[model samples]
Structures are given as structure tokens and as C-alpha cells.
Target: MRKFWSKFKREDGQVMIIFAFAMVVLIGFAALVIDVGTVQVAKRRMQTAAEAAALAGAQDLPKTAEAISAANTVAKLNGGSLIRTTVKAPYQGNSNQIEVICTINVQYSFARILGFTDTDVSGRAVAQKNPQWAGEALPFLNLDDDYLANPKIVAWEKTAPGDFESLWPDDYNVYFGGKFDDHSKTYFTVDFADGITVTKGTVATVKQEIGYIYGQKKPVYIFSLSSAVIKSGKYNNIKNKDVVPLEDLVLLQVTFDSFDEQDKNLFLTTTKVFDINKGEYPTDYLTSPGGTSATIVE
Candidate 1:
């Protein structure tokens, strides 16, 4: 009986108890790693969705409803079911700024053992519209400063008689890549290698501008060009130029009103010109607040 009591008091099973406790700790550490990894992935997904939603929303800045709608659409498209989205315009007292916040939930794997079903993750992005951009190329130029006179307008015309230009096949082959049967009416833009100045009512300018449209396969912004940069061996100087809008001396953004072929040569509509730095606004005419873009301010 004494031997039996001694055996019972012995530390023979202590290792098993220690091992059990250690296993609990080990399982906890594994769970921690898994939960942390899952949360990290969730955070990344949320961040991506947030950025996409923010960009989409910023495209329609100052229009709260439209911005929210676009944000939601992009968030879902990015595979993140948003828990919330906030669109704030005039962010930080800057009328050109827009902000978007997105939130999502992450389901737990081994974390469920710790009584956690899911964790919430959130990401925020801020976008701003700037009035200036450098290096990006423009395929179209405004005939006049009508866009500046009324920056709210989304459609405009030269209001002068000219031949209807076809944009498909030829222009697409030259400037825009991947030719499809686009029957869009083509308008003339500043074809000058230097965007600083222009000669009014110059047929040579029109022809040169048309040549620009046909010269490059794709119009892209070149942000690396220095002020002294030479293109085609010609120095691009924007120091002082008459007839060029003070705002457009650096760059221009022009979008045609439609892809449909128009036989008419002259028309007057809202200004279709915007800054390349500012993203393309909706063509639906949502009352543009003037010159906007998507930039992360925060």
C-alpha cells in the first residue's frame, strides 16, 4: 500500500501534464499565426478595394450620390463587400479633393477556436483633382477658351465651318492602338510638340495638329520631360505664348462628345476640355465643379 501511495505521488505523469499545457500554448500560437495571416490578407484586399472605390468615387467628385454609387460598384467589383463607404468633397478645405473610406469583414480560420468568428478591417483613400499636369500628351485641343469661360460644360465645339474628319482606321492606326471599327467624329487638337503657344486661324496649325493625331499610336502623358527638353530636335518652350489659355499652357485634355459619326462641321456645346491630371469626368453632365483628379492626399 505504501509503495502504491509512493507511486501515485511520483512525478512520472508530470511530463504528460506539462506536454498538455505546452500543446495548448502551441495551438494558441498556431491560431495566432493563422489569424494574423488571414487578417493581413483581408487587410490587403480591403486596401485594394478601398483604393479602387476611392478612384471610382473621385471620378464624380462633389456629387455625393454618384460618388458613393461608384465607390460601391468598384468595391464589389474588386471582390470586397464593403461594410461602409464615405465620400467627402472639399476634403481638408480643398474643393478639388475627394475622400473615400471602405470597410470589410474577414472570416476567421483557426481563430474560430478562440471564439472569434470574423474580424472587421477598413481602409481609407483620398483623391484630389489638380489643375496642372506635365508630360502627358493630348490628342485634342480646344479651338477657343470656351471651356474656361464655362468649365461646367462637358461638350463644346469650334462653331466654325470645317470638313467632317473620320477618326477610325487612320487616326487609330496612328495614335490610338488596337484598331476597331470606330466611327467616331474626329476633332482637331493641339498637335504642336510644344503646348505653350498657338497661331490663331492657321490652316498650317490644323494640318499640323492632324498630323499629331496620326503620328503616335497612343497618346500618353510624359511626366519626365524637362523644360529644356527637345522633341524631334525642336526645343519646347512654354515661357510665353498668346492665344494659349494660361491654364492649358502645360497640358490639355479633350474628349469627343460621341463615338457616332457626325457629318456636321460646326456646333456649340459645353466645354469638353479638362486637365489630364484631372480624371475624365462623367459625360452625363453632372455639373462639374471644375478640374478634378484622383490623388491620394492621405
Candidate 2:
């Protein structure tokens, strides 16, 4: 019995057993760290996908079908599997908001030792399409005299200089005719229904077809209304001779009557009421429908 007891107290194999246990613990900790990091990466990827999809959808608000298509396309492009999406447009009375959720399956690199094959990660985002003051209206000055109700021949020929932006007519005009006496603040930008062809790129436009052109009368619900202190465009050096063909005029839209080359004036019929809200591009407008721009508010 004494001999057996002495043998039992021997340290043989004890160290190997302890070392094996320690190695197993250390490996477990290392594996856990790797798996956690991989999952975090997957979560970030999912978040990116969600945000991209939401923004894409928000741009096409009010149009349900178009918004859905845009969101799906962006999700696939960003490598996220879209789980679901909800959109709230102005018509739906949610202030035009959109939400996107995406997910991803992250395969565990080291956690497989623990029988954990993979984990699912997800992310979500929301966006909104807010109403903005449209700057894209025809070049009409706000008059307190209540003259819009009367069809007036607003002449820009002799009273106004052919203020050309060095000949590259901007898609919109922002010309300033001197100080606040400024009988009229020249601001024009709009998406007219027809009778005008707009080339976003610079096109050699004839002066006759541009600046002083006329067309049939149309109802302009959204007219331009700007304040006294807005950013002004420079038309200093351009002269009448400079208004020759080949000179570009990126005019937004101007169609009031048939091309009566004889009379170069805008005869417009208008309404007095408007939905006053936020203006686009740091605006102070009384009437400029395109004042608002697209942005994420969620």
C-alpha cells in the first residue's frame, strides 16, 4: 500500500495534461475573437446596403413602382439581400419617407470548432422626400400690384440687356439688373410640358429660338417668386452682337405663344395663390417651383 501511494504522488504526465487543457482554452478564446470580428464586418456591409437602397428609393417618391425598382437595383448592386422595404410618399401622408432593411449570412471561420457554422446579420435605414421650393419656374418677377391676373406683355428686349453667361446659357437664368430697384429679378427654371426641347449639355442654340422666343399661351400654376437678396448670375460683358448663332442658351423653359418673330415679349396668364414652403438652393423666392432639391432626412 505504501509503494502504491508513493507512485500515485508522482508528477509524471501531470504537466502534459495541464498544458493540453490550457491550449484548448487559449484556442477557444482566439476562435471567439475571429468569429466576432467576421460578424461585425457582415453587419457593416448590410448597413451600407440598406442605406444605399433607401436613398435610391427616396429619389423617386410618389411613384410606387419606380421607387420599388430603384431600391431593388441598388440593393443588388451593393451586395445586400434586401429583406423588405416600406415607402411613405406624399400621397400616403407620411411626408414621403422610405425604409429599407437588408441582411447577410456570415460564415464563421473559427467558430466552426464550436459547431457554429454561420450567423445572420442585418441592417436598416430610412429616408424621406421632403417638399422643396422649386427654382425651376419661368422668368417672372413677383409684383405686389396684383398684375398676374391680367395678361401683360412683359418685355425683356430693350429694357433688359442680353445678359448672357459668356454665351453658355445656363439651364436656368439668375440675372440681376442693378440694385433692388430691380423692376424684375430674372430667375427662370422649369420642366414645361411641351413646345420646348432642352439639351442638358451645351448646344449651339439660335438666339431667336431661345431668349426672345414666344409660344401659345399655357396655364402656369407654378410661377417664380423670389426675394430681393438671392444669389445673382453675371451677365456683364455680353452684348447684342454677342447674341449670335452658335451662342448657347441653356434656357430652362419659355413658351407663351407662337414664334411671332415680330413681337419678342412674354404674354402670360397667372393665378395669385401658391403653396409657400421651403425654397431650393438658399432661396428667397416668391415664386420659383423648382426651389426644392432631393435629400435624405431620416
Candidate 3:
């Protein structure tokens, strides 16, 4: 028994056993580190790819299949595969939102020695569409009986001679106001039968040339003329050179008379012209305190 005890207590080869145990621990720890790091990197890549794809998809959501294609393309570019994609439209508006899921399968090199295979990396992203006028009210023009009561009488000329005699009666007061500022070159001409009495009031008309200079797609003017105002008017041959480039031009003629108080419809006629190079105008006119019109006369 003493001999057996002596042999058992011997320190020979004890260090070798300890070294083998430590090597096993170190190898296990290294395998864990390798597997965990690989998964983290793959996760990051999946997240970045998903986000970009989702944003691109949201732009065309609720309209076309282009969005799904875009998302898949982005995911593939980032070394990930798109698992699924979905898009939903707003309940009461034109906006839409999208969501995407992506996955990557990564295999560990050194960790495989420890019975580890491949790890799954996944990420999700969401996005939405935005409108042009999301939170603001649009502007419009307003006309009522009060507008015509203070009508400004500008000269009226016939495009061709003998178009017709003046329709306004002379008893209606015809007030010839001074010419608009040089900026307002389009003059208004009034033709009325004899004995018409136009009371002293402000007559308003939109300046013709001013609209052109402003470079607005749809240009309109509002003016008023007061009573008992007249000045010597000379006819000047105005050339079309003063015309400014515009997408659209419109003229609204409103006449107010003694019966204007009872008349609800005061608009006479509206003239509209379109220029292709000027740019496309909104299909619908903006409405403000004034009013909004769906269609403009062409």
C-alpha cells in the first residue's frame, strides 16, 4: 500500500495533463468568438441592405411592381437575400408604406471544428411615401357682386372690325381711368351706348403685360376704376414683343351693372392659352379665401 501511494503521489506527467485541459478550454473559447463575430457582421450587413431596399420600395408602393424588384436588387447587392416584402396604401390618401425582411446565412471557418455549422442573420426595415402639399392650404381667387359694383371700365377693342356695337348702355356711367403703370401695358377699352351712367366707383382689371412679366403659368389680374374719371387716350400700335414667356395665360372679364346686386353669376368670359415650353400647370387650381375653379377656359 505504501508503494502504491508513492506512485500515485508522483508529480511526473502532471504538467502535461494540465496543459491538455487548458488547450481544450482555449480551443472552445476561440470557436465561440469566431461564430459570434461572424453572426454580428452578417447581421449588420443585412440591416443596412434592408433599410435601403425598403426606402426605395416605398416610393412606388400602391402603384407598381417596381418597388419589390428594387428591394430584392438592393438585398442581393449587400450579400443578403430578401425573404419577403409588403406595401400598404394610406386609408384615405395617396401615400403608401412598405416593409422588407432580409436574411443572410454565414458559415464559420474555425468554429466548424467544434461542431458549429452556419448561423442565420436577419433584419427588417420599413418606410413610407410623402405628399407634395402635405400640411398647407392652397391659394385661389374670389369674385362676388361686390367685385362688379366697383367695375373698372377699360377700353374694349374688336379683334376684327364690325364684330358688334357696344353692348353697355350710355346711361351707365363710363369712367375712363388713367392708363395702368408702364408695367401694366394691356389697356381696357369700354364701349357703351349713349346716356349710360356709371356711378363713381373703383373699376378693377388685371394688368395685361404685368401677368407676362411675372412668369406665372396661369396669370390673372384684378383692377378697379372710380367714377367720373376720363383722360385723353391715344391709340398706340403695341407690338407682341412685350409678351413674356409663360406656361399659361388667362383673362377673366367681369362686368357689374345696376342689377349686379341681384345677379349671382357675375363672370362674363374667361380666356386661357397654353404654352408647352412654359411647363405643366396643376390640373386643379388652388383655392383660398377667394375661390377655386376645376377647369380653366382654353
* TM-scores for candidates 1 onward, in order: 0.49, 0.55, 0.41
- State residue 129's C-alpha deviation in candidate 2, in Å: 0.9
Against the reference, the lDDT scores of all candidates come to 0.46, 0.47, 0.39
Q: What is the lDDT of candidate 3?
A: 0.39
Highest-lDDT candidate:
2
With candidate 2 superimposed using the best TM-score fit, by how many Å does residue 281's alpha carbon deviate from the native?
8.5
In model 2, which range of ten residues has the least summed lDDT? 244-253
User: RMSD of candidate 2 to the true fold?
Assistant: 11.2
Most accurate candidate by TM-score: 2
Residue range 1-298, candidate 2, lDDT tens digits: 9988777666546777888899878768877788898888878887888788877887676566787688778877885443443333443365467777777777887677768888778877777765554544543222111233343323223323432111233334543322452323333454322212222222223323333222213333223322211112222233432322111121112234433344433444443333233211322233322343345555
Kindly report which residue stretches of model 3 are placed more than 4 angstroms away from their true locations once superposed: 1-13, 80-95, 133-298
